[model samples]
Target: MRLYWKVVLINGAVLAVATLLLVLGPFSVSRHPVVSEAVVLGVGLLVMLVTNSLLLRSSFKPIEKVVAEYDAMFERLEDERAASSARALAAQEAERHRIARELHDDVGQQLTVVLLGLKQLEQRVPPELADELAALRESTRDGLDDVRRVVRRLRPGVLEDLGLPNALASLANDFAEHSSASVRRVVTPGLPPLSPEAELVVYRVAQEALTNAARHAHADGVELSLTRVGDRVALVVADDGRGFDTRTDGDGLRGMRERARLAHGELAVTSSPAGTTVRLEVPSS
Candidate 1:
């Protein structure tokens, strides 16, 4: 039966029992009652109160059970979703690694060969054409450099070759070199170990936060820190610049959040005119 109908029926039954007692039972209230009549009335009222409490409890039991079942169902669905996201992120990182390898081994080598050929050709060319050939050589060198940069971004060999600490240190140095901002990095000593996936997530989030600070925030100073918090490791990137609206989720912020979710971590972003901070916390192994 519908809950509303069950409630109505229960209330109706209670009212009927009360009416029956008033009409057919021995209890009665006079304009001025003696102690014995008052006692009898009090007893009847107590009986009615107990009966109503019992009925309400019985009627609501099923509802409470249903609510508990729904809560469990939702929890299971959330776990499944998180697992799926983690799998997808793993696949994405694998694909990126493959592409970076191909570019570095194939395209990068081909560009190097072309650059060498240009260098040889420049020596053989006439004096009139030397300037143009030199320009072409320079252009090829630039292209090769660009390719290497892309490969680095796609694979982050530093992260694999070194640990998370060195990877973050390299990132901070890169940011400082490319932007006007000064960066300070602090990694707590003897930190708890983190899983590979968690490390990558933290690295990516810090990278994105620093990129945003350099490109968009126009910050002059930034701080990147990794510390152990309880059983979890926390990565924080804070910049002293014009902050953005936290209500808006840009692509960078969304990507960070997705990465954090896959790692079973929590991400928080706070922004104001004074500065912006992106914080990510993940469990340690």
Candidate 2:
């Protein structure tokens, strides 16, 4: 029983014993009624105190066992869910890498051959057809550039070669080169290393945030910052464009959340007319 009920039972027992002693006092063995009553009351009080103390301690023993079991079950479920999420994320990344490789190797090679053929045709063609050949060559070149950009987006080699910080700088530089928007990166020096999965999460979150700032927010400039905050690392991407309400989760936002979740981290987004800021925090551990 719980302590509350135990105490109530003990009190009731003491009261009943005292009432019995008083009711039978007229036939008591002691010579004086007052002395007999004092002795009975003293004995009853002592028994009540001892029983209450003993029962209170023992009552919660079962409760402790139940609570411990519940805690263990909760942790087991959490670990299973985390494992499932990690597997899903790993599969997704593998698929992306495969697609990137195919595009770069198969489709990209075909486009290169087309460009080379166009160059040869331009040299051998008559002067009247030169303009058409030139136009075709230009179009093919642009398409090739687009394909390369898509391949880079799918699989960034810089991320594997130079680590996350340098990879982020490269991403920002590419974004600036392609878009009119200015991108500024602010990174703290000597940032602690992260697990590969954690690094991917941080990189993807920043990439998506920048894409939203350029495409959805129509921002002219973006600020990306990575810093150490005590025992945690924080990534913040902010834009200067008109922002949308963050209450809705678009595909980009959902993707960011999934990445953060798989990394055992959290993401927070705040938006206003002035701009939007997406922040990710992960434990240094």
Q: For every model shown, what is its TM-score relative to the native structure? A: 0.81, 0.60
The models' CA-based lDDT, in order, is 0.91, 0.85
Candidate 2 global Cα RMSD? 7.0
Candidate whose lDDT is highest:
1
* lDDT of each residue in 206-269, candidate 1, tens digit only: 9999999999999999999999999999999999999999888898987898899978899999
Candidate 2 global CA lDDT score: 0.85
lDDT of 1: 0.91
Pairs that collide in candidate 1 are: none
CA shift of 27, model 1, Å: 2.1
Q: Compare the candidates by TM-score and give the number of the best one.
A: 1
Instruction: Give residue 269's lDDT in candidate 2 (0 to 100).
Output: 95
